[model samples]
Target: MIRGIRGATTVTSNEEEEILEVTEELVNEIIAQNSFLPDEVAQVLITVTEDLSATFPAKALRRFEDWTYVPVMCATEIPVPGSLEKCIRILLTVNTTAAQNEINHIYMREAIKLRPDLSSTKRLAQ
Candidate 1:
């Protein structure tokens, strides 16, 4: 079955290095929490806030992982009023047998400020 794993993270700056570091951490954490296998990931869709245009988050993820064959794409998040800034979010479509509740969703860093409840539950360090 196809399952979706969702995650969001925030960065302090739109610099290339900052984008790369935060994106790497976010993607790595999602994969770890969900126990996602490279071959099982159908596709990964990433979105960065409008302020974050220094680099594509998906590109950072690809460089961090060995999944050269996995399909990944990145886009700018819709600029909604009151939306978080310097944020990067991901929706991973994976072929998994796990139920929705069994899948882990991660929100980290200043991204944690966006979801205080979820932050406590997330295991950081990727």
Candidate 2:
């Protein structure tokens, strides 16, 4: 069976390091929370809010993890009149036997405001 885990995070700045740090953190958390093995991940699709374009968030995620074999693609998120800024979102599809309810979705920073329900359900690291 295949399952998808969703995550979103906001960057404090558009700088390369800041983008890289936050993207890596969110991706790592999503993978850990679901106990997803690298080999089981089918692909990762990422989108960054229109205000962010300094660097591709996927590049940071790939470089930060031992997921050289995993496929990742990134694009600009659709711009809305009053949407959140400097945000990056991810949809990770992985091959797993876990049930839908077992999957963990993450929302952080300003992006947390986009989905308070999911954010409130998160189990953050101690």
Candidate 3:
């Protein structure tokens, strides 16, 4: 079965370096927490707030040696009023036998407010 793991993180600035760094961290945490291999990942969809135009978050995924063949796409998030800023979100669809409740969805930094209930599970490295 295919399962989706969701995660989101925020950067202080819209700089390319910040965006890349935090995005990589977010993806790594999702991989680690869920204990999944890169080959199992079917697709990764990344989105950034309208204010963040410095770079494509998907670029960071390529930095992973084993993720070269994984499909990744980036897009802009819907700009709803009062939405979080400088946030990068990812939905990783993977081929896994794990049940939905077994999956860990990570929310870090200010993005934690997006999913307070799950934020209590663990936290992202600062």
Write model 2 residue lDDT over 1-126, tens digit each, in one string: 998889999987789889999999898888778887889989999999878888888887667556998899999988988999899999999999999987778998888888887872455542
Question: What digit string (tens of lDDT, one per residue) describes model 1 on residues 17-115?
Answer: 988888888888887778878899889899888998888777776685568988899888889999888899888999998997787778886777766
Off by over 4 Å in 3: 120-126
TM-score of each: 0.88, 0.92, 0.94
Q: Is candidate 1 or candidate 3 better by TM-score?
A: 3
- Score candidate 3 by lDDT: 0.90
Candidate 2 wrongly placed segments (more than 4 Å)? 120-126
Best by TM-score: 3
**Model 3 per-residue lDDT at 94:** 94
Query: Of the candidates numbered 2 and 3, which has the greater lDDT value?
Result: 3
Q: In model 1, what are the clashing residue pairs, if there are any?
A: none
- TM-score, predicted candidate 2 vs. hidden true structure: 0.92
Query: What's the best-to-worst order under TM-score?
Result: 3, 2, 1
**Poorest 10 consecutive residues by lDDT, candidate 3:** 117-126
Q: Give the Cα lDDT of each candidate.
A: 0.82, 0.85, 0.90
Q: Model 1 clash tally?
A: 0
Per-residue lDDT for 42 in model 3? 95
Put down candidate 3 lDDT per residue, 1-126, tens digits, no spaces: 999999999999989999999999998888888998999999999999999999998999989989989999999999999999999999999999899998889998899999987762454432
- TM-score, predicted candidate 1 vs. hidden true structure: 0.88
